[model samples]
Target chain A: MPLAATLSSVPVVIDEEKCIAHKGCTVCVDVCPLDVLAIDMLKGKAFMKYDECWYCMPCETDCPTDAVRVSIPYLLR
Target chain B: MKTVEWSVDILVVGGGTAGPMAAVKAKERNPQLKVMLLEKANVKRSGAISMGMDGLNNAVVPGFATPEQYVKEITTANDGVVNQATVYAYAQHSYRTIQELDRWGVKFEKDETGDYAMRKVHHIGTYVLPMPEGHHMKKVLYRQLKQKRVEVTNRVIATRVLLDENGAAAGVMGFDCRSGDFIVIRAKAVILCCGAAGRLGLPTSGYLFGTYENPTNAGDGYAMAYHAGAELENLECYQINPLIKDYNGPSCAYVTGPFGGYTANNKGERFIECDYWSGQMMMEFYNELQSGNGPVFLKMNHLAEETIATIENILHTNERPSRGRFHEGRGTDYREKMVEMHISEIGFCSGHSASGVWVNEKGETSVKGLYAAGDMAAVPHNYMLGAFTYGWFCGENAADYIAETYPAGAKPVIDQTQIDLERARVEAPLLRTDGLPPAQVEYKLRRLVNDYLQPPKVTRKMEIGLERIQQVRADMEHMVAGNPHELMRAMEVYHIADCAEMAARASLFRKESRWGLYHYRVDYPQRNDAEWFVHCHVRKGADGEMEHLKRAVEPYIVELDDTEKSAYDRLRVKREPAIA
Candidate 1:
């Protein structure tokens, strides 16, 4: 079987400046129920790795630096 | 991947609402015993009440309601198909559960006298107890788990329940979401608190994760119990709520109804007298939505400013807090506009309706050494408080059972074949580099659920649904995952498929339409009480194929009068025929 990647806008947005992933912050990643957020080791920042988000928002509320913003997934919005 | 094994006295699957309570209460009962609470997500933010809840949907306060009254109400709401024992048991323990949570720093709305300020939301009872500051409910539960010294494991998806030689539940098997490490926990007993099969249906938004219940609850407990030979009851009576259109979270009539808000049709007229989420209420909501007065709305724009603000404060801060955000994105304001509402996709949830693993008053399932509670357990309209009350029951009961049956040094002899099969099934997707994506497969499967299984169901469509589901089951072989997280989703696909099959089979077996919209078959439009009044049960037969049977509805301890029995039938407000 062949596979192709599709591009779509993700619901959770992380502010790189305030993400503090370089300082070993994973609060957003740890709190997401869907486990959709991941820390990009290369960029040293938290990012939405998967589009599967419930938008339940522990990621945004629990973020220490207030770096995470959970927009209603585009389809829902 | 590697395998990590542990031995414990009790293993509680799912750390959401009931699992944590079960673990804590079990440890409290037998502090010497080793009890572990396993969660697919962090316990701090897991399950339906992950973000805390606005209020208890069914709180049996002393002055407001009695256990008998509560039992009668639930029996009527469930269309008279309840095992009154389980519901009565929850009602009896309801107050104590509330008091315990209150003692543990959980707050409830109170009168000037400091009694539980119960509000009337149901048709015949006052059960709604608001939790204005209930956002910290998880933190409160987490505190209790730590204080009780219950062991907690995070990110491990429990795929199957391991059975002992005696056909008893002995342990659990699965893998961690992040590490792909196979986890095997051997225990004297297991309590399943896995929540509703929320992901069983695809939302109108076309988003796979968008569902009324927390998307994490992929009906893992239901599938595990069925595979373990435990009977599941009334699965045909599916869970379908009136949620915010597109967003797929609740329109929250329970919260708004107490403050004079209601579900209205497009003409902004109240069609149903009550906003309680019963099958009957959903049927009326569905009818109004399909009629000329189409597209129901949660009417709060007519409320006072202070009342609206108070409602907003509670709604925005608690369960699915993102609800407020969704409303804002749509430019919906409680004062300016009525929140648009639509009937949600079908799923199995005993919390709202009676559809789950069968359990007695003691929280013991047909399979010994196995207990279930919370939304997954068949306690009709159990909701949040029932989950906690039943969690306490399962925890204490399982602890007692462990003390009596399994000796201190006793170890369950689990079949190696079970573990081997589960490992192969769990790890297959991770091994493939190129194949189907779990999300796409899940979307396709759930869309089939919406098409064939969504209620106002037809016999031919459901039969076709069974065929299509079998096709999807075969396609699951080609599902490939890129990482452990994707592996978790892939594994959930199997559970969802199992639930889908159970939903279809159970729907077919019942034959008659009951539970209003939950099991409204177009072919069998009339409710046939003579043959189908019994609780319809589904399980894995000796031949390893899905089996369906009817269990007698346990004799009702609190009988309803003829008038009361037909109370829910008159929910549709008689609109005086307009002047022609």
Candidate 2:
């Protein structure tokens, strides 16, 4: 069986301009209970690595630059 | 991956509401003891109250309600199958826990006179205490743990409790979710506070993680207890709540009910006189949804502008804060349209309903040296406060048990064979590349759970559910994980499978319908107190099969009158009163 990449509108979005992950801040990634967010090593910004989210909002609330926005997951919305 | 070994005086698994309290209290009892708080996620934000709570659902504050009254209320609420001693113990210590949290900077809604502004939500007592600014609850607990110097280890998912030759809890074994490194922790005792089996049933949204309880709580502790020879009580009495339809958060009757918002039908008429969460209340809600006036809702459209704003301010800030955003996305405003509500999927949770690892008044499970608290422990309607109080009990009692049973510098002598077996089981998913995805396996298992095990349960369907669950157990061997995170989910699939089997088998064993809608059986449609009134406990039998037992309900300390015994049965409004 072959597995292919699936597309999803990720709930946690990081504004690259405001995200300070390039400055070595991992607050959002560390605080997410689901461990969904990760620091993009190439882009030097935070991104939702996995589509699995509880919409519980620790990532959005703890972001220092106010760059993280957690929208309700599309399936739920 | 290399194996990591840790030895401590006491190991408290899960840093949720109860686990933190258990660790902190154990340390307070003896500051020299090395107490470790192991968590599946970061301790700062974990467990059921990960996002903080809105109110204490069962706060038995003095002057408002006594321990005796609270015991009687829970007894009647759980349909008289409660161990009154456990509920009474919580009641006696409720105020002390409140004061401790208060001293630690937690806020509560109080009147101008500095009295706890208690609200009447239950059928018989005033227990609801609102926490308007409760979003910082975890921060407060984290600060306490830090101050106490409790050892904290995050991202380690403990799968099984290690047992000694005498069947006593020696420690625990699992692998770290992020690194895939096997972990072995040896201790004199182990406390299991892993929250509800929230992932047992997939949400109606078809989203796997959108469960009412925090998605991380995959019934890990319940499975751990059973595998360690601990007995689980009331496995058939499932937790079914009235939640916001697709979002699966509480429409929060406790918060809105006090402000005059209520559960209403399609015509916007009150059907249930009380909005408190009880099996009987859910039964009425289910009946209303099934009737011509289908799609029950949280009706707040009739409330005054000021009241709605106040309610929104609190509801949007605590507990499931994203609830407001979900409503906004759907264009459903409290002042404009009613919030749609539906009955939640079934799972085992003693916090809301009575289905969990059985524990006595001291928070000790049948297995020696193993303690359980919080949502997973079998204490009915315990809610958040009960978790804290029971955590205090488990922490203090386990500390005493360690002092009495094990000498200082007593180290656990664990069997290497047991550790090797669990490691192979945990690592098998990652070793296979061509195998089923954990999510797909979980989705199918939970779908089957809904189809055959969701209640008004039929005997034949449940038996079929048992067979299907066993099939999933077989498929579990082939469930593959691409990474450690997926491995964590794969392990959770195993836990959910165990719970699904427990739910089906226990539901079949009861032989009678009880707890209103919770354990309603289609075949055994009547409540038979003559033969089925005892607590139904399930555990791993000596033959390695799931075994069922009928433990007689502990004799009641506070007896109830005939009228009080049937209080929850009368939740439906006598007349359909509609707002003009």
Each candidate's TM vs. the true structure? 0.99, 0.99
Each prediction's DockQ against the real complex: 0.84, 0.82
List model 2 lDDT by residue over B432-458, tens digit each.
998899888999999999999998899
For model 1 the local lDDT of residue A23 reads 93
Q: After superposing candidate 2, which stretches have Cα over 4 Å from the reference?
A: B576-580
Worst 10 residues of 2 chain B by lDDT: B406-415
Query: Which segments of model 1 are wrong by more than 4 Å?
Result: none
